[model samples]
Target: MKTLQVDLGQRSYPIYIGSRLLEQADLLTRHIRSKQVLIVTNETVAPLYLQQVLDNLSDFVVETVILPDGEQYKTLDYLNRIFDTLLTHKFSRNASLIALGGGVIGDMGGFAAACYQRGIPFIQIPTTLLAQVDSSVGGKTGVNHPLGKNMIGAFYQPQCVIADMSVLSTLDDRQLSAGIAEVIKYGLIREPDFFAWLEDNLESLLDRDVEALAHAVERSCRNKAEVVAADEKEADVRATLNLGHTFGHAIETGMGYGSYLHGEAVAIGTCQAADLSRRKGWLTDADVERIIRLFKRARLPVEPPAALDANRFIELMAVDKKNVDGNIRLILLKSIGEATLPVGVEKALLVATLNGYGRKG
Candidate 1:
């Protein structure tokens, strides 16, 4: 097993990445500060791996909340359900919440732990690639609001993150591809060599090559950990991680959630960001096509939904968390391996990019 650390001083935690790491009791038990444990998972994930986690935690007092699976379910109402479970069980502040599914569960569970009795310990056992690489590592936990994705959330760190590659075998193809979108984001933002490696190895990753998937997960986490360490509160540099998320979140909320996978929307959003970069004379047409081709090769959607137009996109993005003084800040590419954000882009250009690029005719 390979362990990487997210250095947050007092809040520092280790991310354990390897195959079958979930079967190890000590790895998880050592992180739990209290004897009480609340395992928050979804219906889809519980059937596959819940028992394994429970077996490892047999010694602790445990309660499980199996949530309905999907992005649409990530609401304040559902978040309340988690609190209800905790309250019903009389789980104390010392109780630890274990997030045991994909991003949805991680976000909700982490948020629950953060708000429960003014914060309690939580561990992340992310089952999906998207969660393992992105959502699980950084302490950015929250549920989506009707107005925005992750609109209501907190920067609460996890006690530890356990990513077991063995569990990934059960994931469907579309779900696996969705996770790769986040993997691709790391390359687009800061790792030129990693991007090149992905261009060559994306096929192997799609085929579920163990080494490729492991490398992708570890590298993605390393990149994310470094960024989060630098700006835990997203005061600066860390916002770069949302390279395509602003446009992507608008897609999720506009489409009414769960209609399109988050990673699919991110792939489309990355294409749009690349297109906007081209319009700003930063990326050449070839660069834009290269970006699109990589996403296409990953079986991700390269075009935005036909139903959303420039006006609708503008209205949706208006609520973006990165906006400053009402100007929607965007993370645009200066090159294939570098991104710049908080850009005060022209409205007309944004409108044109939204309408002209990545729009399905």
Candidate 2:
């Protein structure tokens, strides 16, 4: 078992990552003070690992609400269902919520817990690799609105994050690839050495090598934890973590929710950011090629969705959360291990880059 700690002062918590971390009752006993417990999951995951969590929390009064799985279901209407479930049960502030699925369930459950009587305790049992490495770490929780992804959300931290790698065995290839995209981001944005490390061990990771997966999960969590500890509310330094998000969110939103996986869009978006950097002479083509090569190895999409047009792309991006005043503040590449926000990217350059987006037809 591998344990990574996210130190947020009083709100600090542990993210337990390993093969069988899910079945440990004591893993959650310390943080859950309530007898009333609600475990939130989706249809797909409910059939898989819900029993493990329920058995672990047998001492507590466990209630459940299973939503249909997918990005399209991540909306206010679905989030309201959680409220309805909690209200129907008469769960009080003393109650606790457990997010037992992937990022969607975790975000919605955490948000529901945060708003339920001005915040109650919640635990994150992130089942997906993407959820374990990204959503389960930063404490950013919310449901997506039609206009943007995670545009309407809160920075509510969970009491703890339990990441059981064993659950990942049931995940489909696309979901696994979505996770590797995030792991790649941690390397590209913060740790140059880690980036090199990924370049060396791509095959082992793709094969689900236990040691590789554990190290990747731990290192990615560590990078995110450091950023969260430094800037909990994304004041400035933390926004760098949004590296390819401005364009990626637009891709996800414009393509609609389910067209591409969140990490799939992010994979292509990172490629685009690197391309933009190369165009501006910020990153060498060699650097860009290496980044794309790694994404390909993970089976992640490295090209944008073909349906996007430059005008629509720009219009959607204008509304990104990272935009300040009227100008879009993009997190572009500086090098393999570094990134930054250059003041105002040119319109022609942005349009041409969008026009040149290459991917499967």
Candidate 3:
């Protein structure tokens, strides 16, 4: 097992990445603060790996809450279900909640743990690549609001994150592809060499080569851990992590949730960011083309959905949490590996990019 630490002083925790980690009870139980445990998962994942995790926590007084799976289910009503279960079982703040599925489960479960009794400990057992690489690491937890994605959330870090690469074998191609979007984002926003490596080894990634996937997860997590350690609250550098999130959240909220996977929206959003950057004369046409082509190679959408036009995008994006003082702040790339959050982008330029980039103009 390879361990990477997210150094947040007292809040610090190690991310354990390897194959068949779910079976390691010591790795999990050591992080639990009390005798009680809540394993929160979705319907799809419960059948496959839930029993195994329960078996590992055999000694703990454990309860399970299986939520209906999907991004649309990430709402206050469903979040309350976790609280309902915790209360019904009389779980205390000493008890630790285990998020046992993908990003949605991790987000909702972590949020539940965060708000329950003001705060409680939670561990992330992220099953999907997207969750393993991004959501499960950063301490950003919340359910989606109708107007925005991840708008109602808190920055509550997990006790530890367990990413079992073996579980990835069962994931469908679409889900696997979704994870690669975040991996690509790490490269686009920070590591140019990682981006080039992805350009070269993307085929290996698509094929699910064990080494390639492990490297991707470790590298992505390393980058994320460093950023989180530096700017835990997104006060500064951490905002770069949302490179494509502004436009991506607009797509998600406009589509009424779950219409497009978060990573899918991000892939399209990154393309939009690249286009806007190109418009600013920061990136050459070839640079933008390379970005789009890499996303296409990863089998991600390189264009925004047709249903939401430029005007709708503007309305949905106006409420983004990253906006400062009513002015929208965006993570725009100066080059492939460098990003900056520039404020007060002219509305006409943004509208033109949104309308022209992916639409049938």
Tell me the tens digit of each residue's lDDT in model 3 across 55-114: 998889999999998999999999999999999999998999999999999999999999
Q: What stretches of model 2 exceed 4 Å from their correct place?
A: 359-361
The full ranking of all candidates by lDDT, starting with the best, is 1, 3, 2
lDDT string for model 1 (1-361, tens) is 8999999999999999898898799999998888899999999999999999999998899999999999999999999999999999999999999999999999999999999999999999999999999999889999988777898989999999999988889999999999999999999999999999999999899988877889999999999999989999999899999988888999999999999999999999999999999999999999998999999999999898888888899989988989977778899999999999568789988998998995545
Give TM-scores for every candidate, taking all chains together and pairing residue i with residue i: 0.99, 0.97, 0.98
- On lDDT, who's better, 2 or 3? 3
Please report, as a residue range, the 10-residue window in candidate 1 with the lowest summed lDDT: 352-361
> What lDDT would candidate 2 get against the real structure?
0.88
TM-score of 2: 0.97
Pairs with backbone N, CA or C atoms under 3 Å apart (clashes), candidate 2 = none
Please, what is the whole-model Cα lDDT of each candidate in the order they appear? Answer: 0.92, 0.88, 0.92
Model 1: residues >4 Å from true position, as ranges? none
Q: Tell me which residue pairs clash in candidate 1.
A: none
